[model samples]
Target: MPEHAEAGPSRTRPRAPRRKVYPTETFIDGRGDTLAIRTFAEEDTDLAGITRLCDEELSEPYNVYTFRYFLEDWPHLTFFVFPSADDPEPIATIICKLDMHRERTMRGYIGMLSVDKAWRRRSIARKLVELAMSRMELAGANEIVLETEFDNGPSLALYEAMGFVREKRVHRFYSNGKDAFRLIRPLAQHPLLSMAALRERQDAEQRSMAKEGGDNRSAVPPEIAVLLAGPLAPPTAAHADAMAELASLTIEPLPKPRPPPSYIM
Candidate 1:
């Protein structure tokens, strides 16, 4: 009765849930305690804590390969925070990536961010995100994007407060079949300039082609003026006949090739 299912046989048992990462220290929000944020390093290849944190915080589980795909290429984008020098694991962690987008603009992506449950509401997550964003901005990212559960009010509010806008809704995005909302934060890109502002500028530049009433179609862009030239696209007589002949044809089966004689015999 499920709408969608995998092709292979279902497993008899569920996977062992990843280990939970607990904070070793409390992040003093406004108290200004000594914060211990550290970037990821090659020596810290054992990513058990980060994997566990993402599995629990997100709707999906990230295996070792998935973690490596991002971490290996952009280790600087991954960060952690410890409460004290003796803390073994991070109380907070954020992972991100940066690259050029198809639109020829630099883009940054926040893949995962996790903060220990005990350290919630203490500004730990905010600090981690800001740190990552700042680094990515400095690294030439023009915009950033991320996805979160649509119902996660705290996450939505937190990111929105940090200037991320809800861009679109993804239908059934998670493995557990939950919908997600994709958020985007433009670092220095002026979206208004591309949208309404661009439109206004273009409108202001619009000129009458017939102002002097002499062969005037040069006022608009070449493509627009071409479109205004009207619908005179017609096939030649021979081409039209060929097309009609092709359309009247029916599908025919091709003979299957015979196999060569067996060498084993």
Candidate 2:
């Protein structure tokens, strides 16, 4: 493998086998239609539909090893969605895994999330992440993280809106030489949303309260105020948004100061 192509996690197989106890879940789409969300079963091994969705919606390629690595380690975290109970192919899918990331922190990583292009803008990806996060939190995750192509606006916006913060940029992170952003969010250790997000929410709520009636500002939650006071920037890694563009401006140096004119010739 090329340099950094096979990271520590990618080279090592998961310590345990994958397991799932959840049943098919009913999800409501933006169209007010019902959708089925379920885990990948052993017999449901045909992943062509999944690979197609990933290929169409994502910029990178996922081979059989990548798919098996995630599914075999945490089948419950691998989810596929159908338009309905009888739908033949999955319209969306998400793969997730849990592990001790540094310092013994139980971290939950969202490996992949893809939604059919036809199903774009329906908040399907957001719903898929929510489902996975809920399970991860229940499983005792201290934090959650994922990476997205630097230019993937929709994906970045979705994760950021859900309280994930851009930690840093991985240069040449993609096979095509494009960069990527590693986004993260704290789970059990802190609130689900970022402090900035909570502050925004509080501001909105305060405005609404004022609009309804004045003098109830005390209704604001205390923890929210504390979080609002915290540093505005989400710490850990540089924000993903910062990597959107590189500083390309070229500044020319000013001319060197001329010494007192020594008698012009």
Candidate 3:
């Protein structure tokens, strides 16, 4: 997601016209499961859930938040929540802020990305980041930047895999003196980033069709064409079956060489 620079204690500037925002909603997963992704509206219930998730799963000491902080500032920030399919409660959250310092450059600041302990490694965080990037792009952001603890290997790797690069490292950047690394990526630099995003959505749709035990390759949406052109891991049973059906439709396939590894981040 985009990163926002820390605003100084200067006089408040005039606010820009607010864009039309839709209601928070869920995205259907590969198993016909619903994953809620919504804007942060200051409400008691949403605040409570966000607080619990951050306290429990994102216990980093450098974190900052307060009740008044949310009430007073959260409206200007972009927030999204991912609710668990089984429990019907929030499992993860991502916060983004728009940086107005640069023209036509929306700095995508990522803060408070946390997933429930029980929901780790299921691509929940990845999905959240993907959603954030999409939203930022839709908002006219040409690039995204974020910082993470230097020692956070999993996050570093995930961001790298998704096309971010280590732009700089600051010593003792956090209040507790932990070093931090700033990662940045241009949204248009890597074609694969968009492809991966499309694939994820396609995978979700394919899973929905498979749940009904019906073959529906014809239902493949045109918007998800990029995903159909590549191989994806954690494939649903229906995705595999659909691939098989597609394979039978073609003949005399040519041999191809393995592609090189990507090291964008």
Candidate 4:
């Protein structure tokens, strides 16, 4: 994890930095042939190259303008590229949006996940997703979700193998009237899931909070209970103080009624 900037003003605060867990390259063949998987950064002209590749290779029209859009709007979204290890240039790509709804929810919606036909069946898409999820989890997402064409057997199987279950099926969701299946995977659970260890980490957190007299009932209001329980971001001292003040106010009794409305005349 490369430290970029702290979440808070203090340098001592833990920063949610992005790290490339999987190397930018991986062996694709037993004979030492490899492929490079890289997260896209701003000012990368490779987006246009990969977009052109997808267009020419996959006949994908929807993504024709995606690369242009990505270059215009980077950072708000994440893009990953896969290049033949021998070439070390982008040949495939995937894009994901972080906090799409701004609900302070640790979730991401994957879009435009694709690999070139030349690289099909090479497990490059799967590797791209794995790499994306690692960055997403590290950035504080607890769940990652995506939608794919119902007829895309390979994509469906890949997602299922990665523990993504079909959450919904929408009819004619695509521009071409093809149905789409929405799949989701909780990053903090299930075996083989990269972030599964977070469950144990959360348990340890609960135990620590308990030791510090930080019961949920005392600290969180019913309205925001789910948010409080979520792993979005830890509260600041001011937030904690506000909650404590609210809790104290809620526990205080109403002031005694003023002498029954003064007397009637």
Candidate 4: which stretches are off by over 4 Å?
1-32, 41-44, 57-60, 63-65, 68-89, 100-104, 189-265
- C-alpha positional error of residue 92 in candidate 1 after TM-score superposition, expressed in Å: 0.9
TM-score of 3: 0.53
Worst 10 residues of 1 by lDDT: 256-265
Candidates 3 and 4, the one with greater TM-score:
4
Q: What C-alpha root-mean-square deviation, in Å, does candidate 4 show against the real structure?
A: 20.6
Give lDDT per model, in order.
0.69, 0.73, 0.63, 0.60
Best by lDDT: 2
lDDT of 4: 0.60
Q: What would the TM-scores of all predictions be?
A: 0.62, 0.62, 0.53, 0.57
Name the TM-score of candidate 2. Answer: 0.62
Q: After superposition, how far is residue 44 of candidate 4 from its true place, in Å?
A: 6.5
1-265 per-residue lDDT for model 2 (tens digits): 7876755556666689554333577978887878888888763554776788888887787776677766666778878888876665889999888765543466788888989888877778889899999998887677888888899887888899999999998888777889889998987454434555667777788788889887647355554454455557454223332332213332342233232112100
lDDT of 3 by residue, 169-239 (tens): 97776656788898887877334566666677677777887897877553655324523555654566656
lDDT by residue (27-135, candidate 4, tens digit) is 4632345756555654443556556655675423654344444434434355545554345456677777545233324566676676666667767677678777887
For residues 1-265, write the lDDT of model 1, one tens digit per residue: 5669657777688889764333333355644766566777653433876876787766676677667767767888988887664565667789887765654556788888898886678788898888889999887777888898899999999999999999999888776788889999987653433445444544445544355455543544433333333346444554455456646762342232232112100
Score candidate 1 by lDDT: 0.69
> What TM-score does candidate 4 get on C-alpha atoms?
0.57
Q: Is candidate 3 or candidate 4 better by lDDT?
A: 3
- Model 2, 221: alpha-carbon shift in Å? 26
